[model samples]
Target: MALYFFRISQGRYSGASDQPFEFDSREAAWTEMTAVCSNLLSGISRGLRPNSEWRMEMLDERRKPVFCIRLTADTLD
Candidate 1:
C-alpha cells in the first residue's frame, strides 16, 4: 500500500487533508478523487464565483503531486 493525500481548492479557498490514506493502487486513488469531486459539486448551487473553478490534487506520500482533477464552469453572458 501507499500513502496519499487529497488537496482540494475552490476559487480562493483551498485546503488539504490533515491525514494520509492508504491505497493499494493508483486507480483506487482516482476513484476517491472522483467521489470528492462529486461531493463538492453536489453542494454547488450556481458554481464558484469570481473564479468559477475547483480542483482536487492528489499527492504522494512525499507531498508531491501525482495527479489532479480540475473543474471549470462557464456561463453565457
Candidate 2:
C-alpha cells in the first residue's frame, strides 16, 4: 500500500467541527474525510445546518501523484 499525507483545509470549521486534521495514509485519510462529509451532508439534508465546505490537498515532495488521493467537498458533490 502507498503512503500519503492528507490535510483538511483551513477555515473550514462551522463551530461544530475541528480544523486541520491530518492522516498519515490515503486509506485512513479517505475514511476520515468521507465520514466528516457524510455527517455534514446529513446535517444539511435534515435542515439542521447549512452546507459546510472543505478543501482537500495532497502534496508530494517529489512532485508525483502516484500515491495521492486528494478529495474535497466539491469533489464529493
Task: Give the winner by lDDT.
Answer: 1
Every model's TM-score: 0.80, 0.34
Q: Each model's C-alpha lDDT?
A: 0.84, 0.43
Clashes of 1: 0
Error of 1 at 75 (Å): 5.3
1-77 per-residue lDDT for model 2 (tens digits): 44343443424441222233356666675676567556555544453323434444443333233232223343345
For each candidate in turn, give its C-alpha RMSD to the true structure in angstroms: 2.0, 8.0
Question: Which regions in candidate 1 have their CA more than 4 angstroms from the true location?
Answer: 75-77
Pick by TM-score: which candidate is best? Answer: 1
> 29-62, model 1: which lDDT tens digit per residue?
9898888778777676355665488788999999
User: How far is 52's C-alpha from truth in model 1 (Å)?
Assistant: 2.5
Lowest-scoring 10 consecutive residues by lDDT in candidate 1? 42-51
Off by over 4 Å in 2: 1-19, 46-77
